[model samples]
Target: MQDGSDWYGAATATFGDRVAGAREALGMTQPELAERLGVRIKTVRGWENDTAEPRANKLQMLSGILGVSLTWLLNGEGDGLDQPAGEAGARLPEIRTLLSELRDIRADVDNAAERLARMENRLIEALTEGRVE
Candidate 1:
């Protein structure tokens, strides 16, 4: 005798169900998850519908992004939304690292833009100071 409650558990849930559960448990929308994964919304939809499966690289990234183990994401056997509190805390380090990297990249771009502006100003000054040949 089995009640339908099992359907909601990872043990009997479909792949799509697990994906959607993890995404929601992380407080992420489909679009946000897709953007983080660098995938199209349609691709995400396909995955959630069980029409497709992510490749190994994407699977690894998906697990990390969703703060779940690969096995849990695949078969609901390891660690899924069953432990939401711990999962959320586990993702902090990765998020912090990503934020730091983005800050470094932004700084590099700003420095390059400033150097380009200075070069342009120097060129303009030289052109205005000299007579045309």
Candidate 2:
């Protein structure tokens, strides 16, 4: 950290940030990673969104699958992907903002889907009860 070469250093990147970066660097989608790690897609989503984390066994498997050290994924202090250079590096913050926005949208979609399921169940009950006109 002295030379400041690590863009996603321990001070800046969270566990989720490192996990997402490593996954993206390997060209893997959340579903793909989740399947490989034998977890649900939402589990992967939760990990990336910082809403949840994996267990120790899953963490080890994740590091192997993503080609990053467990230490780096945990603290961004070991062997890990380098941040893009020059122009790309300049856009890193912008990229992060967009990713944040996308994650928000994903949450909205999940919420909406859950609401739809509840509504559908209610409608089914209403029909069975002869409440609908």
Candidate 3:
């Protein structure tokens, strides 16, 4: 599995198979990849076991970290690992930083949406109770 040819076959590989193959090709342990992605090791295990899939943002980060295209990561059919390991490592810091910012922005948006929902509920209750008249 170290060479990424382990997945070559007539049948289409599952998402987990691609993930495991790519990680193995990169010589990355599950723990190492999880730490780089800022996720728990169990999360990586879940992905590799086909028990879970990463969120879109995490998938993007995983692609970058694994030096494979997102399409390849998902379906195993695309430009996979065109870059050497050193080149991939060179781009990792930038990609990680951008991903972190995106995550923070997403969190803020979620919090704002929650607050708006609460406010809307309060307004609806007040109106229905004749308190807003």
Candidate 4:
């Protein structure tokens, strides 16, 4: 957060941007966030991907839990988080490197989830065909 920027500002950031940035700023993993929200990890992943949205109740909870205003999360209008202040210049490269690694890890997680779903579907089909005990 030492980059001296509104990493999740309203300018052109989407809801996903706010959610993911806030989560990372807080050092919360996706599974941790899901547990706190009483939802599946997939739900959190979808939010991060901008592929789905939470219901109103979940939305309220999300804002509260994430320590960000609802308006900011929705349309980036109200209060949003600031990066943690510190010596940034020296760590800028490291932060960028870690962020890149995090993205790659997230992609792998998403891929694994999709593969798991496919495997589950295959098992279900096998059961339906009376091929599995």
lDDT values for all models: 0.71, 0.81, 0.70, 0.77
lDDT of 3 by residue, 53-107 (tens): 9999999999899887777777665656333356544775575466446545655
Q: Is candidate 2 or 4 superior in TM-score?
A: 2
Model 1, residue 22: displacement in angstroms?
0.5
| CA displacement after TM-score superposition, residue 48 of candidate 1 (Å) | 0.6
For model 1, how does the per-residue alpha-carbon lDDT over 1-133 read when each residue is reduced to its tens digit? 1122233244545677678778887799989999999999767866776667999999999989987778877777766665334554467457546644654565566567779999999999998889676
**Candidate number with the higher TM-score (1 or 2):** 2
The TM-score obtained by model 4 is 0.67
Which pairs of residues have clashing backbones in candidate 2? none
- Which whole-number lDDT from 0 to 100 does residue 122 have in model 2? 96
**Ranking of predictions according to TM-score:** 2, 4, 1, 3
lDDT of 4 by residue, 9-125 (tens): 555456877898788878999999999999999899888877689999999999988888888888766677764457754465577567656656886888898999999999998
Poorly placed runs, candidate 4 (over 4 Å): 1-6, 83-112, 127-133
Residue 121 displacement in candidate 2 (angstroms): 3.1
Model 2, range 49-129, lDDT digits (tens) per residue? 777889999999998998888788888877787876788677877876887788788778877888999999999998899
* Per-model TM-score on C-alpha atoms: 0.55, 0.78, 0.54, 0.67
Indicate the residue-level lDDT of 122 in model 1.
97
List all candidate RMSDs to the true structure: 13.9, 3.6, 13.4, 4.3
Q: Cα deviation in Å at residue 68, candidate 2?
A: 0.8
Best by lDDT: 2
Using TM-score, give the best candidate's number: 2
